[model samples]
Target: MLRRARIGLALGGGAARGWAHIGVLQTLTEAGLAPDIVAGTSIGAVAGGCYVAGKLPELEEFALSLTKRRVFGFLDFNFNGSGLITGKRLCGELDDHLRPVQIENLERKFVAVATEYGTGHEIWLSKGRLVSAMHASYALPGIFSPVNINGRWLMDGALVNPIPVSVCRALGAQVVIAVNLNRDIFGRGTIVPDHEATDEGPQGLEDLARARSSR
Candidate 1:
């Protein structure tokens, strides 16, 4: 009898970096376990493409150089009046989750919060500030705010907290948090954490290979 099987794999950290996509493809080629279908989120799409098409020798170097140049150019602008915070929460199969509580303790300012799920629930918050106060809050860790990237508000991290509801709705995920804010790119972007899952990475590769072989 023939059986149908499936597996899930997750890769994070520097390994998920843009240039590293080529490396992942090369490794898969060497192992003879090339993926039949490749799908990814955010920058992972770039890597997934390289894996299927085979690596170009200078691709990784070029990608890295471009990223650095873009970042540096944005930094030169010296705009410091924006701030953001991101949080993620895990709501395990809950229904009608409340959206984040938005508190307005001061005029023309607000605080937003929400939950996210990957391996678990995550929460994010973003705080926006007036232009004059921007510089004083630079490099404030654990917060997501607009970073000047290539002369644009990249919306890198700080936007995460305000958009969880939209992300959940779009992705059809259960609403583990309340608040019906318009989900934007904030909580919808890439997240990189250092915890390793039990069946990810090489073990995942091996399992895929085994399943393919059995089929």
Candidate 2:
């Protein structure tokens, strides 16, 4: 018997740009290039997690239904944590879509990356509660609140591994296809120079996205 090369997909972190991952997955499926293992960071975690849960279509519908008003309506602002939004409403909506899925039971290998708040260590979530893992991975400092698990506060994995290509390899992938939505922003001729630097960075994902769209 011959062995099939396991294909791994590394989904990058880019907040709203992560929505493009849905299209990427759809295209891959149509081209008969589906991944055997999937790894993601930040919003990539959300999309990849939902895809692994077999509820990606529902997730797409939820995304499509979002309007400015509706998106604002999801805000549950607070000052208790590192971010403005408490993440309760956001997690609630996500839980509605991925209520009972656990990482340990998934048919395909899945990984979600988060960063330890104080140490900046990369946390690879491959077990336990799936929704919580997704939230921890999606939690962005100064935007969405940090998630605590086992006495450690965790935030977006973009601080460390935005593309998580190493994670895909760690999972025993024979081949890796990484989708980096941050390409345009990080690529040459894209980012603003040091002269245009601002002390106040983007307060939220929307602000960063708007800046990207403008340029």
Candidate 3:
């Protein structure tokens, strides 16, 4: 009997940069690389969830249809909470794409990571509602409100594990391939020295003591 090694794909978080994941997944498909398990954090959850649910093309269509005004259309601003956007419209779109499906029912294993708000701990969502997990994983603190699941507040997984390679290992993957989108983002930017860069404060022992005490 021949057995195949279980391969896991790890997706990283990077706001709008996460869009590149669609191309990555499409390329992987064209190359005949099918992962047994998928683990993702933050925006990675959205992409991975779509892939696991076999709705990648639909998600790609939605992404391709976005414009500046159309992007803003998803924002339902509310000043009552930490985040400015309600995120209801965006959630509705995700629900339209991946709802009515359970993680347990998926053909392959999928994991979405989120950060426990106050505890600053990693929360791995591997079962239950798929869309809920995706929503929780990418809910940025100051942009979109944190999601409350089982009485615990969860924000973006980027706060903890942006690329969940360890999560893939824990899930019994024999091989893990991680994609990080936060690389080389600053390469094209110039670092111009500002006047504040030369300022050094609290040189003396007394001033240093005062500064330390203020904290």
Q: In model 2, which range of ten residues has the least summed lDDT?
A: 188-197
Instruction: Give the per-residue lDDT digits (tens) of candidate 2, residues 1-215.
Output: 99889999999999888889999988887898878999888999899988988888988998899999999999999887579998989889988877778787888888888887887767777876778888888889999888876555778878888887778887789999999887632211122111110122322433544776898
Question: Model 3 — which ten-residue stretch has the worst lDDT?
Answer: 189-198
**lDDT, model 1:** 0.28
Where in model 1 is the C-alpha error above 4 Å? 1-10, 13-18, 49-58, 64-71, 74-215
What TM-score does candidate 2 reach?
A: 0.83
* Per-residue alpha-carbon lDDT of candidate 1 for residues 19-110, written as tens digits (9 for 90 to 100): 55566556756876533233222233223322323333444654656666554443332234333332111111000121221111122111
lDDT of each: 0.28, 0.78, 0.79
Residue 82 lDDT (model 2): 75
**Clashing residue pair totals per candidate (backbone < 3 A):** 32, 0, 0
Q: How many pairs of residues collide in model 1? A: 32
TM-scores for candidates 1 onward, in order = 0.29, 0.83, 0.83
TM-score of 3: 0.83
lDDT of 3 by residue, 62-179 (tens): 9999999999899899798779887779989988877687877889988888876887767777767788788888999999888776555777888778888878887889999888
